[model samples]
Target chain A: MRAACHAPIRGDFTGLRGLEWDKMLHCPAQAARAIPTISAATSMSQTRHVFFISDGTGITAETLGHSLLAQFPDTRFRNHRLPFIDSTDKARDCVQRIKDAAIESGIRPIVFNTLVDPSAVAALREADALFLDLFEKFIEPLENELGQRSTHAAGRFHGIADSQDYKKRIEAINFTLAHDDGVSHADLAEADVILVGVSRSGKTPTSLYLAMQFGIKAANYPLIPEDFERNRLPVELTRYRGKLFGLTIGPDRLSQIRQERRPNSRYASLENCLHEIESAQRMMKREGIKWLDSTAKSIEEISTIILQEVRLDPQSY
Target chain B: MRAACHAPIRGDFTGLRGLEWDKMLHCPAQAARAIPTISAATSMSQTRHVFFISDGTGITAETLGHSLLAQFPDTRFRNHRLPFIDSTDKARDCVQRIKDAAIESGIRPIVFNTLVDPSAVAALREADALFLDLFEKFIEPLENELGQRSTHAAGRFHGIADSQDYKKRIEAINFTLAHDDGVSHADLAEADVILVGVSRSGKTPTSLYLAMQFGIKAANYPLIPEDFERNRLPVELTRYRGKLFGLTIGPDRLSQIRQERRPNSRYASLENCLHEIESAQRMMKREGIKWLDSTAKSIEEISTIILQEVRLDPQSY
Candidate 1:
């Protein structure tokens, strides 16, 4: 069964503009009053129920499910995440919860499942919903191509299978913490990547992400005004020229970000931000260090670009 | 265009056991020699090439693709991630890269694409690979269910859409950093969850994961010998009893973890680990705080369980 019925248009008609803009500016109350006739005409469902169930952490299921749901911008989805459903009893309970959501929504709920255990999957298959068995759909094709059967193991993806890899990730996190903000030169040579940026230009979070997610020992150094006056990179960083990557933010965004930390301070002024960014860019160019603008991108985007631009293999790290 | 032909078995015969065992112990050299006759007989292909292409960071495509590939454990896949493929020019360049991979590997490459732009998707369709368009497959069904045409936007999943949400994530990161290891008690009241655990028991990484992934303000405190000696919870944590969550690790695992940090020290001894764990468990039970074992679970699993146990809505944070 599928939830093909139309739902009530609860929000703004501005969405109908079909242009990409800031969604946070969307005022629901004003939208409701702006298109009363359309809202009155469409009234079949309230909210669609979406469930992401997995044998492990359900991160993959939730991520893929969310990406699919984002395609429909006007629809409201009430999401339910059921992770670590490895046992048949837990799967049975999951089926009950999904059935309840289906009944509550007056339509079949959409389920994105990544359960690998046969018994648990069999139990969850009893649920009356649009069951999108993510693992089952792709495993057969992969098995055929590989000329082998899958392990059908539960919790393998996110599980700590390799002790060495797990230890590396933990060590990387500790290394990053100890080396944060140029606090330690003890292990500068051990770092896989070193980030340089003006204060609050998104160095710490990016370094943490590289360490936590990819097991890359990332060290970050703040490019202060002293370096700008000297017209040179930090003396400590000169030895690791190949590992250095720069982050630059737009002056306006940098100023706004700084204002939150220090209200009405000279450091938070737009002129200071502009000067700092220009100097950082010039130094990076002189040092032949590749850099990117962090003003409009998320940390994930910035990290991925850094990895590609620096040609750093995360797996090797 | 699918590469359905069998590939040469390069790894060990022990994988034929089909039993859940330590994959890290599977020595490829031994496996290659053990199955020499079978390896000699099969000579169709060497390795398969896979690409993850998207308009944004391509994280979702890479994640889902990795999950699918994990099902085929015996096969070797060469992965190429191409992010920010937003224009037709970039998509055409991406097709050339895939074609080059196909030529190099002597097999048709597998492409997992999440490009939303119609022109870019069309340009990528010219590639000679098993094109698995993730967004296209699900968007049409979603559009039918929602009874509206999709905006066909790109980079919506990981893009910083809401400035408020972005700020909350940054603030959460900062809050978790400041509160790490009980360094600060200034904003304990603002925390959504506070984790208590012995040192090296996986508290810091889990706290950071909670902050980074969900934007939930998490503070973690280390339970030291003083608290165990006193046989009570910390006085500062007594007021916010409802937000307390405990993490315990297996004594053996804890000892090994500590030994890496401080070798041959009394703190890393097995006896000390056992006593600390027992005392922490007793204190947690006495205080009626919920807790979990963090020895075998990843930070993602532990964080998800903590959120569920505490009934903390990450979205609300």
Candidate 2:
């Protein structure tokens, strides 16, 4: 007899709902027999099925859920996202799925939900799992504090509530895209903030994040060797001194990032990265442009800092 | 006498900190005299100050806080974000800022925080505000449920904890960028999902969202008028039927989106939008490819559906 395989089968729950626990746990007999070492590869960590259910996109529940779960690094969570659970029928389906996950894992599943509809919330609460209703816990307190009744809207949080705001965000994304890596100088004046950095110091992704998340038109320009030789800011950027923000990276990290893009090239050399970053920093200092080190920072962190430092007028963009 | 200006002064706290409340509330004398009608534009809505504080990016705090605050549509919130508050000194500064806002608004501020460090949390709790520490409420319950102590780590949620995962996300962003709007066919085989849609049907933003948030390499191709005329799926996408996901929008919404790009043109006409969407949907139906209506759905909703329907193997990507 082949040894039992402990790794959970990862896929959609629809096909696995009716399967027996033994069948779900075991690999195919032929494959298990062929790979006798499979049983030895079993993970020692505890496994728990986790679900993020919401009336809208479920992004909030998932984001907060992930943050909470990150604290418990010892356990492995088999994650599932059930988004757009607007109707009672969908809520019922979600409950059933949660129950199935509990049965399959032989552990009560942990669910984080942001359903606002009372009926839908009540329906999902019937599942035999640790249901953490995110909205239910705070809505009443908020209502009392605000001295008004909440709309209790299902999809309002992520919905396009304000058409003007939505349009501005879309425009920002387009502006960011058009100005990416100094591709176009036609509308440098329109940029809410312009990022200048050595290539791969993390300007592109940061710019995109600023636009996508905050509706800020961010443009980025690369500080190449020619700029360093000239020891001056780009002519296109000189006029927009107030909008300019610089990004610098550690030489080692810059080289490591570039190494993946262009292996065994002069551009990926540590010496080159060092010289470029130093030159960029010196120029930024001389020009009185604010800058940040993006060595270990996430794009969100970098964007947040830029927003704080740049202090762009929200109404202007 | 000039009626008091009601709009909250929006700018950096450093400049506003020591200013008298009257000076902060009222517009400049010259401007107020010139624009005498400003008093007529005073908003009657209740105003409150809101703050999101965290040891990391504070994005999770802001996201959840926004969701909660959206319930109260009647109140205007003067929002502030104090991110990367990992030290007691920073937390003290944050508390001071909150107090300043409270004084300026003549109402206690509402603070949402996700600080993990005990010293920082304690320091921030000193503010004369309704402090809602997000982590404090959830961490204990989670700890009890998991039967393990949390690591109590600051900045772990958004930091580069797993370098491999971070690298994959960066690669995904690059891949999505290169493959955006069918700009490159060099790595079509590597895309985790290919989105097919008519122009301005929300393919690019959705693709970028999938890449940025979920670390999925998503490529998008617009089903142009030529594709509708040919009445067929694009030849390049035919081989990857399983990876294809289509996005269809209401003709009116599509036309409006296109109008923003090219105003008063045939491309932005409702008739053209309808024909392109119908043909694309028909082709997708014939090919048995899954798709969604992007008319009112946010990019997060669309991407979640695609991830669910496509069910790509995590290991394969």
Candidate 3:
């Protein structure tokens, strides 16, 4: 990886110096426009580079970095993850790579470091970039607040506390997978929440998200035309009224979403969508079930709201 | 929420004052051991309270805070998330809750904040707690590195970007869902990667993660007894050789995992697991297919290694 980065910098810089200073700046931009790969090596504004450096799996760094970067949608970034940078040698090599990237791109890369070792962190600080140390910024304050010093351990963030947590999450996943689309009636009562909605109304994703993120057993049952026509909850769900959460979408949006799956069908028609949604909404209201319009909500927002309303904590089993 | 917090504080603190000074502190610890919920309210050493405060979905704060807290596994935390604190009044309410928590618990709380607006952030800072602001700590350095100011806009982190990104992810998900278990051979060629594995070998979660996180269209096909008996790749998979990635598991682990799903069946038998794994490994090696043992890895780890090995960038379409 180091050789790959350095190889491009040495070759590019030598060729860059042969041209006049003014042309040197302009030539790369023109070449970059013509060739997409050259954009990272030429224009700083054209590409923003981000490196998530961690001593473990780098998932946490990537998750936090991605969330932060998502706020800047106008900025385009090329991302890289360097996980298991625990030693001083690896940290030094990482710094060199960042510097080489800076030399080649005329852009300093942003480094999100979760490196806990002081020496390794210091080595990375020498790089020609913005080094944001996640631990350094918060650890001391946390220690003082808690009246305890941190262990500064690596990989603990992802280490299975016991087989229990792993088992719980997997069981939730398996339950969510099995109970999907009301496939199994036996486990309906076991679900923390039963999500009801029209087809493609974001039930599958939301159920999976709830199970995966919060260890909540979420079972989703689609409200079909039969149930809509009857204007009643499914017989199996009538017993678990307290666990039911309803999801509805705008009729036009539902039509558009369904049309993509099966075009020109009655199932994907706007009339069907309106009828199903109206019937489902009426049923939910009559039963005093809280519901959300999922047409404009992201899965995260929808899941968060549901979790809050249900009083489920992500940490609790 | 405000009423809930203040009600507890008013009830708990006065009772705490009536006890002897040293016993007031020690009594809570004793009470905490007897009562788990009291651990959050009484003993500082017995339990740590953490607040992930954000002006958005709070995913970033929860993720980073969880990672940091994971290091101190010995310390138990009672966590609360306060999202969408977009106004000063909301911020003030948040501070009041934090202050009340401190009064009730007899310990200061640790706050992980992602507040962007200056006034809202300042209001949160006034609370008697350890305030670790993610944006405040890293944004200025990022600005210096990029030679530009940040927009600090709320909701952009998760806002739908011209519907293109949302569409691509959803399409990938739909494709993955459709192509799951080799349900549709017609679109096999459209997949960016195809996962071949045995039953319950972590294929479903891995495929979903790749599609949802990286926007990679992944299809998974199970390696069955037929493929094992023949000691060859499936005929349907031969055409998309370059896109094939294999997942294997330790026989014992596989048996244990499968036993939970279908106890005492041939599918969950140790003999069946050994035969399947041995045959699959031999076939994968003979076919020059890259594979990984998923027995000891999480879905995140499995998906990440696959993405890295294939050199797929999540940022790209």
The DockQ for candidate 1, computed on C-alphas, is: 0.18
Models ranked on DockQ: 2, 3, 1
Interface RMSD of each: 14.2, 10.1, 13.5
Backbone clashes in model 1, listed as residue pairs: B12-B31
Backbone clashes per model, in order?
Answer: 1, 0, 0
Q: Which CAPRI level is candidate 3?
A: incorrect
Error of 3 at A62 (Å): 2.6
Better of 1 and 2 by DockQ: 2
Q: Which has the greatest DockQ?
A: 2
What C-alpha RMSD separates each model from the true structure?
12.7, 8.7, 9.8
DockQ for all candidate structures vs. native? 0.18, 0.26, 0.20
lDDT of 3 by residue, A1-317 (tens): 11111111221221111112121011112112121233254444467667888876576677667666765666777677765576787788777767766765567888888998888888888898877778888888777766678888865444455568777887887788789889898867789899988888889888877876667899999889898777788889999877888888889999999998899999999998898888888877677666778888767677776765454566521
Give lDDT per model, in order.
0.74, 0.74, 0.71
- Between candidates 2 and 3, the one scoring higher on lDDT is 2
lDDT per residue for candidate 1 within B1-317, as digits (tens), equals 01111111222111111211121111111112222233343344678878788887777777777777766777888777777777888788777767766666688888888999999999999988887777876777667766789888888755666678878898999899999999998989999999998998899999988998889889999899999998989899998887888888999999998998899999999999999999988888778766778887778888877765555545411
TM-score of chain B of each: 0.85, 0.84, 0.84
Q: After superposition, how far is residue A87 of candidate 1 from its true place, in Å?
A: 2.7
What is model 3's DockQ versus the real complex? 0.20
Model 2 DockQ class: acceptable
Tell me how large the interface RMSD of candidate 2 is. 10.1
lDDT of 2 by residue, A1-317 (tens): 12422222234442112222232121233222122221232332356888888877677887788888888888988777776777787788777877766666678889989999999888888898887778876777677777889989878645666767877887898899999998999899999999999999999999988988889999999999999999898899999987888888889999998999999899999999999988988888778766778887778777876775565434211
